[model samples]
Target: MKLQLRYLLVFAFLCFFSVSFAQRKKEIPQTTRLLFVLDASGSMNSAWEGDTRINIARQILSDMIDSIANVPYVEVAMRVYGHQYNFKQKNCQDSKLEVAFGSRNNNQIRTMLDGLQPKGTTPIAYSLEQATKDFPNDGKDTRNVIVMITDGIEACDGDPCAISRGLQQKGIFLKPFIVGMGIEPKYAKGFECMGRFFNAKSSRQFKGFLQEVVKQTLGKTTVTVELLDERNQPREANVHMAFIDQATDKARYNIVHFRDKGGKTDELDIDAIPTYDLIVYTTPPVLKKNVEIIGGRHNVIKVATPQGQLNIVQNGSLDYSTGHSAIVQKQGNHEILVNQQVNEPHNYLIGNYRVEVLTRPTTVFENVRVNQGKTTTLNVKRPGVVTILNKLSGYGSIYVVKSDGSEDWVMNLPEKGIPRTNFALQPGRYRFVFRSSEANDSSYSKSVFFNLSEGGAFTLDILRL
Candidate 1:
């Protein structure tokens, strides 16, 4: 009995240990992998302050690696270019990944940097292209970062800006953190689109820039999408929102705004970036393009999408079908606002619109204003349908002439085989002019005056012309 008890206790302890280990593994977040794209071209040997640019970069990078030694779930790698070939050898493809990304790889990186010597041409663009393959193609949870330390621009004929932009568009890597070692001010403009350029003039400045870059790459920032009502207040919540990359127009983050216990909008932790396009899926959809988000700061985007209810009434009946009514915007170009049929009242963005009702004569209410948080009720008068029974054996079209002698083309009455064509006309006094398709003279056509006032169907018999 004693031996059996002791075996039972051991089994219980092993089961607890297994469960604890699995829970701990599940708690660990995804790794942040950073790649250092070092430039070892001949220009790196030039003196910057009291030491060569390469030497300064090597020392600062070593120290930076040491500083992050205690950070959890972090991996680092290094790639060097122009260090293996001579300057006159024309070796533009001299870049190589010296150290692959892994934890506790600092000693390998430092040893490799110590042995590198600046010799060949600077292939900044080629090195960056190669670095894209060094990262593991794991799930999207892993954050891939690149820190480019270079003193000169691309010596090869490759376009680094285009390469960087392409990489970002492909979602392979984030915006690179470029530490320009003693780069001239006039030449700095050339690298504006490559990445976030940090012009380091001295050793201290270089070290500080690297530290900041590491902190930013390893950290996350908060972004809040404030859905504003008509009064520009943050009273709206539970709306779907998307953060789109401006370079690619690809959605990077999507979330629904819900107030927390503190009655404030919930903030999301997104990878640090310079700007994003905030898109809100409101009634009519709202877009706030090119919103800038600075690192280590809380960003709040106040999106004004005040909407009003549009209730359309046809004649004396309420018709919610969107097919019968259309609200179009009156702006630079006419844009249709609401066209879908709604059995109930629907919301629309507050603006001026032209409400068109598909009545007999197609009633149009121009300059209709939709106010915020209020219902804009539109009542349309139905027009009378007029059917023209043609007895003449000819192809012709009918035109309606108004009191001012202005003519509007109605419908074409086909050849003698077709008996009639229908026309929806509003309450008005007008004259109908019938012109034969083969006739060129206006006097050869027939004309008649007709007045329509009631909202019902009527037939006009054309016994002769």
Candidate 2:
């Protein structure tokens, strides 16, 4: 009897251990994976006001990483392009990944981010494909994100948006936020269109685009669901229940039972609902059921960190820098941009972040180009200014190199930023090419040639492309 009792105790201990292990597995933190797709194509080598844009990008990214160092349970990953040897001979076909996905150890990520310089053809599609592999959809509860920063249109084969959509269709909600650096205002439309489609535009208001992205991943909310009938009426009048993460793509459902409307309620698991349809009063005489529901409003309560706090937004970036609070008691799924700002260096952590993200900038430009006589009458088309702007402040200066290889003009101006310059010469067989001061700087543009009429008036139209 003694031996048997000992054996029984051992068996019970084993069962307890198994149960504990299973519970621990269930409690693992839901992960958010960020993939940094830094452009290393040839066009990123230019300098901005003598400062290399690549260097600036490195500093900014480093600062960002340092800012988020204190955020709990957050991990980051990075990948770079244009590191191919003999990239020119390869027709920019060699846009390869130098760093695979990995955790952002300050030292490791810093080294990788700092070592990047622009060069090579823009293989936007290929880089995205490589990054997708970093986020495996094999039943892992991880939110995947792709932050692609580029300054030019794609030079490699395959469409970036199509590739991103394909990944999304595969159960991977890949939100791609594009950062256009050192690109002309005329070409900003395509980037804006991409942001609109993905619902992830980095508002140009305060350079808080990337910061807003970080806040979005860190922010959480609790939603209360009160199921209503097809008549657009509330079934459980004034009976409140809470569902966590109510307004986000990832929602946690918890049901509460209030004995009566406006009365004390017992918090219960959502699964405790009598039926999947969540209908009560299921019995005899009345023969009533909260049957077949549709077309009802959902109230989404978005809560920011530091608990029960609020933020005020100006433009797309946050104006409330320090301790500020606000509540959003909005209903329905809002596809709106939220911005958060952290002004002080020490307060740049998760709870201290002030979230903000602005709407697309107001741009004024029609698709028209007129080439006039000795004085080429160029119309200034943009909401803010006629100067060139660098949406993505990385890579390097953008050099407008003439196809003849005679002289090149490099630009790194902000909004209404750089002054326009005119060229005096006999315009014949001239093609415009762009260059960057990065590792992938050798990729040239398709040469377009036009003849200059010796005396008669000749017109040439240059697309934003």
Which prediction has the highest TM-score against the true structure?
1
- Cα lDDT for residue 350, candidate 1: 80
Query: Per-residue lDDT for 1-465 in model 2, tens only?
Result: 999999999999999999999999889676666677777666667665466556656776677777765565565677777655434754545555455544556567788777665667777777777776666555756767667766676677667767765665564544466766666766666555333212222223213655655554455422233333233333322222333221132323433334345542232323110111222221100111222111122222211111112323222123222332221111232332122222221111011221222211111122212111111121211111112222322222333335566644323323232233222222233333333233254663223333332222233222232
TM-score of 1: 0.74
Question: Which candidate wins on lDDT?
Answer: 1
- Expressed as tens digits, the lDDT of each residue in 301-397 for candidate 1 is 7898777777776562232122455545543346665563422466667887676665433556777788877898876665666778875665555
lDDT of 1 at 359: 49
Residue 353 in model 1: shift from native, Å? 2.9
> For model 2, what is the error of residue 94's alpha carbon versus the real structure, in angstroms, after optimal superposition?
3.4
Q: After best superposition, candidate 1 residue 213: deviation in angstroms?
A: 2.1
Regions of candidate 1 where Cα sits further than 4 Å from its true position: 1-31, 46-51, 69-73, 88-90, 138-141, 227-241, 254-263, 280-287, 304-309, 315-322, 335-350, 382-465
Return the TM-score for each candidate structure: 0.74, 0.43
Q: How far is candidate 1 from the true structure (C-alpha RMSD, Å)?
A: 8.8
